[model samples]
Target: MQFVIRKLSPNDRLSIVTFSDDAQRLCHLRSMTQASKAHLEDLVDGLGVINMTNMEAGLKTGHQILDGRHSNHKVHEHT
Candidate 1:
Protein backbone atom coordinates (compact mmCIF):
# COMPACT_ATOMS: atom_id res chain seq x y z
CA MET A 1 0.00 0.00 0.00
CA GLN A 2 0.98 3.58 -0.64
CA PHE A 3 0.85 6.35 1.94
CA VAL A 4 0.95 10.14 1.86
CA ILE A 5 1.89 12.49 4.67
CA ARG A 6 0.65 16.03 5.24
CA LYS A 7 -0.13 18.65 7.83
CA LEU A 8 -3.17 18.62 10.05
CA SER A 9 -5.37 21.60 10.85
CA PRO A 10 -6.89 22.39 14.23
CA ASN A 11 -10.13 20.74 13.23
CA ASP A 12 -8.22 17.73 12.11
CA ARG A 13 -6.64 17.55 15.52
CA LEU A 14 -10.05 17.70 17.14
CA SER A 15 -11.36 15.02 14.82
CA ILE A 16 -8.39 12.82 15.59
CA VAL A 17 -9.01 13.09 19.29
CA THR A 18 -12.68 12.42 18.89
CA PHE A 19 -12.13 9.45 16.64
CA SER A 20 -9.50 8.03 18.93
CA ASP A 21 -11.78 8.35 21.91
CA ASP A 22 -14.59 6.68 20.05
CA ALA A 23 -12.38 3.84 18.97
CA GLN A 24 -11.12 3.39 22.49
CA ARG A 25 -14.67 3.24 23.74
CA LEU A 26 -15.54 0.62 21.18
CA CYS A 27 -12.50 -1.39 22.07
CA HIS A 28 -13.36 -1.26 25.73
CA LEU A 29 -16.84 -2.46 24.97
CA ARG A 30 -15.28 -5.32 23.10
CA SER A 31 -12.93 -6.11 26.00
CA MET A 32 -9.84 -5.03 24.10
CA THR A 33 -8.55 -2.43 26.54
CA GLN A 34 -4.86 -2.95 25.85
CA ALA A 35 -5.21 -2.72 22.14
CA SER A 36 -7.47 0.34 22.45
CA LYS A 37 -4.99 2.36 24.51
CA ALA A 38 -2.04 1.40 22.38
CA HIS A 39 -3.81 2.17 19.14
CA LEU A 40 -5.16 5.51 20.35
CA GLU A 41 -1.86 6.62 21.81
CA ASP A 42 0.01 5.64 18.67
CA LEU A 43 -2.46 7.49 16.51
CA VAL A 44 -2.32 10.59 18.68
CA ASP A 45 1.46 10.64 18.66
CA GLY A 46 1.65 10.11 14.93
CA LEU A 47 -0.79 12.93 14.32
CA GLY A 48 1.20 15.20 16.64
CA VAL A 49 4.31 14.61 14.58
CA ILE A 50 2.47 15.17 11.35
CA ASN A 51 0.96 18.38 12.65
CA MET A 52 4.30 19.78 13.79
CA THR A 53 6.03 18.86 10.55
CA ASN A 54 3.28 20.33 8.43
CA MET A 55 3.19 23.56 10.41
CA GLU A 56 6.93 23.96 10.00
CA ALA A 57 6.78 23.24 6.30
CA GLY A 58 3.94 25.70 5.84
CA LEU A 59 5.91 28.39 7.60
CA LYS A 60 8.96 27.74 5.48
CA THR A 61 6.98 27.64 2.22
CA GLY A 62 4.77 30.64 3.07
CA HIS A 63 1.68 28.55 2.50
CA GLN A 64 -1.23 27.93 4.87
CA ILE A 65 -1.30 24.61 6.66
CA LEU A 66 -4.27 22.67 5.42
CA ASP A 67 -6.21 19.77 6.96
CA GLY A 68 -5.63 16.23 5.86
CA ARG A 69 -9.25 15.91 4.81
CA HIS A 70 -10.51 19.40 4.05
CA SER A 71 -8.02 21.49 2.09
CA ASN A 72 -10.08 24.68 1.92
CA HIS A 73 -9.05 26.48 5.14
CA LYS A 74 -5.85 27.20 7.02
CA VAL A 75 -4.84 24.84 9.84
CA HIS A 76 -4.70 27.51 12.50
CA GLU A 77 -8.06 28.96 11.44
CA HIS A 78 -9.94 25.73 12.11
CA THR A 79 -10.34 26.46 15.78
Candidate 2:
Protein backbone atom coordinates (compact mmCIF):
# COMPACT_ATOMS: atom_id res chain seq x y z
CA MET A 1 0.00 0.00 0.00
CA GLN A 2 1.05 3.55 -0.60
CA PHE A 3 0.12 6.77 1.18
CA VAL A 4 -0.21 10.10 -0.48
CA ILE A 5 -1.29 13.46 0.89
CA ARG A 6 -3.25 15.88 -1.22
CA LYS A 7 -4.31 19.45 -0.56
CA LEU A 8 -7.92 20.13 0.22
CA SER A 9 -10.15 22.53 -1.66
CA PRO A 10 -13.77 23.61 -1.58
CA ASN A 11 -14.64 21.03 -4.20
CA ASP A 12 -13.85 18.14 -1.88
CA ARG A 13 -15.94 19.30 1.06
CA LEU A 14 -18.94 17.12 0.37
CA SER A 15 -16.84 14.02 -0.15
CA ILE A 16 -14.97 14.73 3.05
CA VAL A 17 -18.12 15.17 5.06
CA THR A 18 -19.50 11.96 3.68
CA PHE A 19 -16.29 10.13 4.43
CA SER A 20 -16.18 11.46 7.97
CA ASP A 21 -19.77 10.58 8.61
CA ASP A 22 -19.20 7.08 7.32
CA ALA A 23 -16.20 6.72 9.55
CA GLN A 24 -18.11 7.86 12.61
CA ARG A 25 -20.95 5.50 11.85
CA LEU A 26 -18.59 2.57 11.31
CA CYS A 27 -17.07 3.20 14.71
CA HIS A 28 -20.45 3.46 16.33
CA LEU A 29 -19.44 6.79 17.75
CA ARG A 30 -22.35 8.54 19.38
CA SER A 31 -21.10 12.00 18.61
CA MET A 32 -17.93 13.77 17.74
CA THR A 33 -16.69 16.85 19.54
CA GLN A 34 -16.52 20.00 17.51
CA ALA A 35 -12.77 19.82 17.57
CA SER A 36 -12.86 16.27 16.37
CA LYS A 37 -15.17 17.10 13.53
CA ALA A 38 -12.98 19.99 12.53
CA HIS A 39 -9.98 17.77 12.68
CA LEU A 40 -11.55 15.26 10.35
CA GLU A 41 -12.52 18.00 7.99
CA ASP A 42 -8.99 19.25 8.06
CA LEU A 43 -7.78 15.76 7.37
CA VAL A 44 -9.99 15.46 4.33
CA ASP A 45 -8.71 18.81 3.24
CA GLY A 46 -5.11 17.70 3.62
CA LEU A 47 -6.06 14.36 2.25
CA GLY A 48 -3.61 11.50 2.14
CA VAL A 49 -3.72 7.94 1.01
CA ILE A 50 -1.89 5.48 3.23
CA ASN A 51 -0.92 2.01 2.18
CA MET A 52 -2.21 -0.12 5.02
CA THR A 53 0.33 -2.84 4.48
CA ASN A 54 3.07 -0.32 5.17
CA MET A 55 1.58 0.53 8.54
CA GLU A 56 2.46 -1.55 11.57
CA ALA A 57 0.48 -4.75 11.72
CA GLY A 58 -0.71 -3.90 15.20
CA LEU A 59 -2.28 -0.76 13.81
CA LYS A 60 -4.04 -2.74 11.13
CA THR A 61 -7.16 -4.54 12.21
CA GLY A 62 -10.92 -4.63 12.31
CA HIS A 63 -12.47 -1.36 11.19
CA GLN A 64 -9.06 -0.26 10.02
CA ILE A 65 -9.86 -2.33 6.97
CA LEU A 66 -13.03 -0.36 6.38
CA ASP A 67 -11.09 2.85 6.82
CA GLY A 68 -9.36 1.72 3.65
CA ARG A 69 -5.59 1.93 3.22
CA HIS A 70 -5.41 5.35 4.82
CA SER A 71 -5.14 6.05 8.49
CA ASN A 72 -7.22 8.94 9.68
CA HIS A 73 -5.11 12.09 10.01
CA LYS A 74 -6.23 12.25 13.63
CA VAL A 75 -4.87 8.81 14.36
CA HIS A 76 -1.84 10.30 16.02
CA GLU A 77 -4.11 12.60 18.00
CA HIS A 78 -5.98 9.56 19.26
CA THR A 79 -2.79 7.88 20.33
Candidate 3:
Protein backbone atom coordinates (compact mmCIF):
# COMPACT_ATOMS: atom_id res chain seq x y z
CA MET A 1 0.00 0.00 0.00
CA GLN A 2 2.37 2.67 -1.24
CA PHE A 3 1.42 5.97 -2.84
CA VAL A 4 3.25 7.71 -5.66
CA ILE A 5 2.82 11.33 -6.71
CA ARG A 6 4.75 12.97 -9.55
CA LYS A 7 4.36 16.69 -10.15
CA LEU A 8 6.37 18.47 -12.80
CA SER A 9 6.14 22.22 -13.00
CA PRO A 10 6.08 23.94 -16.35
CA ASN A 11 9.79 24.49 -16.06
CA ASP A 12 10.51 20.94 -14.90
CA ARG A 13 11.19 18.07 -17.29
CA LEU A 14 11.59 14.28 -17.22
CA SER A 15 13.30 11.65 -19.28
CA ILE A 16 12.58 7.95 -19.84
CA VAL A 17 15.16 5.23 -20.37
CA THR A 18 14.76 1.58 -21.39
CA PHE A 19 16.86 -1.39 -22.42
CA SER A 20 16.28 -4.14 -24.92
CA ASP A 21 15.20 -7.53 -23.62
CA ASP A 22 15.53 -11.02 -25.00
CA ALA A 23 11.80 -11.04 -25.76
CA GLN A 24 12.28 -7.80 -27.73
CA ARG A 25 9.69 -6.09 -25.63
CA LEU A 26 9.47 -2.33 -25.67
CA CYS A 27 8.81 -0.83 -22.27
CA HIS A 28 7.92 2.82 -22.01
CA LEU A 29 5.46 4.93 -20.18
CA ARG A 30 2.44 5.94 -22.21
CA SER A 31 2.17 9.30 -20.47
CA MET A 32 3.38 11.22 -17.45
CA THR A 33 -0.14 11.93 -16.29
CA GLN A 34 -1.19 11.22 -12.68
CA ALA A 35 -3.43 8.33 -13.66
CA SER A 36 -0.69 6.61 -15.67
CA LYS A 37 1.81 7.01 -12.90
CA ALA A 38 -0.66 5.48 -10.41
CA HIS A 39 -1.27 2.54 -12.69
CA LEU A 40 2.45 1.90 -13.06
CA GLU A 41 2.90 2.05 -9.30
CA ASP A 42 0.12 -0.47 -8.82
CA LEU A 43 1.81 -2.82 -11.26
CA VAL A 44 5.08 -2.51 -9.37
CA ASP A 45 3.33 -3.33 -6.12
CA GLY A 46 1.76 -6.41 -7.66
CA LEU A 47 5.16 -7.61 -8.80
CA GLY A 48 6.51 -7.19 -5.32
CA VAL A 49 3.70 -9.33 -3.94
CA ILE A 50 4.36 -12.03 -6.52
CA ASN A 51 8.07 -12.04 -5.77
CA MET A 52 7.47 -12.44 -2.03
CA THR A 53 5.03 -15.25 -2.58
CA ASN A 54 7.53 -17.11 -4.72
CA MET A 55 10.28 -16.69 -2.14
CA GLU A 56 8.08 -18.01 0.66
CA ALA A 57 7.03 -21.00 -1.41
CA GLY A 58 10.65 -21.82 -2.17
CA LEU A 59 11.57 -21.70 1.51
CA LYS A 60 8.77 -24.06 2.43
CA THR A 61 9.83 -26.51 -0.26
CA GLY A 62 13.43 -26.46 0.91
CA HIS A 63 12.37 -27.13 4.50
CA GLN A 64 10.28 -30.07 3.44
CA ILE A 65 13.17 -31.58 1.50
CA LEU A 66 15.52 -31.17 4.41
CA ASP A 67 12.99 -32.73 6.84
CA GLY A 68 12.57 -35.74 4.60
CA ARG A 69 16.31 -36.33 4.41
CA HIS A 70 16.69 -36.09 8.20
CA SER A 71 13.84 -38.52 8.82
CA ASN A 72 15.34 -41.06 6.43
CA HIS A 73 18.72 -40.77 8.16
CA LYS A 74 17.18 -41.41 11.61
CA VAL A 75 15.24 -44.47 10.45
CA HIS A 76 18.30 -46.06 8.88
CA GLU A 77 20.32 -45.57 12.07
CA HIS A 78 17.60 -47.27 14.21
CA THR A 79 17.44 -50.31 11.88
Candidate 4:
Protein backbone atom coordinates (compact mmCIF):
# COMPACT_ATOMS: atom_id res chain seq x y z
CA MET A 1 0.00 0.00 0.00
CA GLN A 2 2.80 2.38 0.92
CA PHE A 3 4.60 1.67 -2.32
CA VAL A 4 1.48 2.27 -4.36
CA ILE A 5 0.79 5.49 -2.52
CA ARG A 6 4.34 6.70 -2.98
CA LYS A 7 4.14 6.20 -6.73
CA LEU A 8 1.19 8.53 -7.15
CA SER A 9 1.94 11.96 -8.59
CA PRO A 10 1.19 15.25 -6.87
CA ASN A 11 -1.51 15.96 -9.42
CA ASP A 12 -3.30 12.73 -8.65
CA ARG A 13 -6.07 12.48 -6.15
CA LEU A 14 -5.75 9.44 -3.95
CA SER A 15 -8.18 7.76 -1.60
CA ILE A 16 -7.39 5.06 0.94
CA VAL A 17 -9.99 2.62 2.17
CA THR A 18 -9.51 -0.46 4.34
CA PHE A 19 -11.88 -3.27 5.11
CA SER A 20 -12.26 -5.83 7.87
CA ASP A 21 -15.54 -6.20 9.64
CA ASP A 22 -16.51 -3.19 7.55
CA ALA A 23 -14.95 -0.63 5.23
CA GLN A 24 -13.32 2.63 6.19
CA ARG A 25 -12.58 5.55 3.90
CA LEU A 26 -9.52 7.00 5.59
CA CYS A 27 -8.85 9.76 3.10
CA HIS A 28 -10.79 10.81 0.03
CA LEU A 29 -9.41 12.29 -3.19
CA ARG A 30 -6.66 14.25 -1.48
CA SER A 31 -3.85 15.71 -3.55
CA MET A 32 -0.82 13.45 -3.55
CA THR A 33 1.71 15.98 -2.43
CA GLN A 34 4.65 15.35 -0.12
CA ALA A 35 2.92 16.78 2.94
CA SER A 36 -0.35 15.16 2.04
CA LYS A 37 1.45 11.87 1.48
CA ALA A 38 3.05 12.15 4.88
CA HIS A 39 -0.31 12.84 6.45
CA LEU A 40 -1.83 9.92 4.57
CA GLU A 41 1.06 7.70 5.58
CA ASP A 42 0.26 8.60 9.16
CA LEU A 43 -3.33 7.69 8.51
CA VAL A 44 -2.18 4.36 7.12
CA ASP A 45 -0.25 3.76 10.32
CA GLY A 46 -3.55 3.86 12.18
CA LEU A 47 -4.70 0.65 10.53
CA GLY A 48 -4.60 -2.37 12.81
CA VAL A 49 -6.12 -5.80 12.96
CA ILE A 50 -9.46 -6.33 11.28
CA ASN A 51 -12.19 -8.96 11.39
CA MET A 52 -15.06 -10.57 9.36
CA THR A 53 -13.16 -10.04 6.07
CA ASN A 54 -15.98 -8.10 4.49
CA MET A 55 -14.54 -7.62 0.98
CA GLU A 56 -17.94 -6.57 -0.31
CA ALA A 57 -17.98 -3.52 1.88
CA GLY A 58 -14.42 -2.71 0.86
CA LEU A 59 -15.19 -2.79 -2.86
CA LYS A 60 -18.40 -0.86 -2.34
CA THR A 61 -16.59 1.88 -0.49
CA GLY A 62 -13.95 1.96 -3.23
CA HIS A 63 -16.61 2.37 -5.88
CA GLN A 64 -18.18 5.12 -3.83
CA ILE A 65 -14.86 6.90 -3.69
CA LEU A 66 -14.58 6.83 -7.47
CA ASP A 67 -18.29 7.39 -8.02
CA GLY A 68 -18.78 10.39 -10.27
CA ARG A 69 -15.83 9.49 -12.48
CA HIS A 70 -17.87 7.15 -14.62
CA SER A 71 -21.39 7.18 -15.98
CA ASN A 72 -21.97 3.41 -16.02
CA HIS A 73 -20.17 1.91 -13.05
CA LYS A 74 -21.18 -1.64 -12.27
CA VAL A 75 -18.98 -3.47 -9.76
CA HIS A 76 -18.89 -6.89 -8.20
CA GLU A 77 -17.33 -7.94 -4.92
CA HIS A 78 -16.70 -11.62 -4.38
CA THR A 79 -15.46 -13.12 -1.16
- lDDT against the true structure, per candidate, is 0.28, 0.34, 0.33, 0.73
- Candidate 2 whole-model C-alpha lDDT, 0 to 1: 0.34
In candidate 2, stretches whose alpha carbon ends up further than 4 angstroms from where it belongs are 1-31, 48-79
Q: Provide the TM-score for each candidate, comma-separated.
A: 0.24, 0.26, 0.29, 0.76
Q: What is the C-alpha RMSD of each candidate to the true structure, in Å?
A: 14.5, 11.8, 17.9, 5.0
The TM-score measured for candidate 3 stands at: 0.29
Greater TM-score among 1 and 3 belongs to 3
In model 1, the runs with Cα more than 4 Å from the true position are: 1-15, 18-32, 49-79
Q: Among all windows of ten consecutive residues in candidate 2, which has the lowest summed lDDT?
A: 21-30
lDDT of 4: 0.73
Taking all chains together, the TM-score of candidate 1 against the true structure is 0.24
**Model 3 RMSD, rounded to 1 decimal:** 17.9
Q: Give me the displacement of residue 5 in model 3, in angstroms.
A: 7.1
Instruction: Kindly indicate the candidate among 3 and 4 with the higher TM-score.
Output: 4
Per-residue lDDT for 26-60 in model 1, tens only? Answer: 11112224444445456555542322233332332
lDDT of 3 at 38: 62
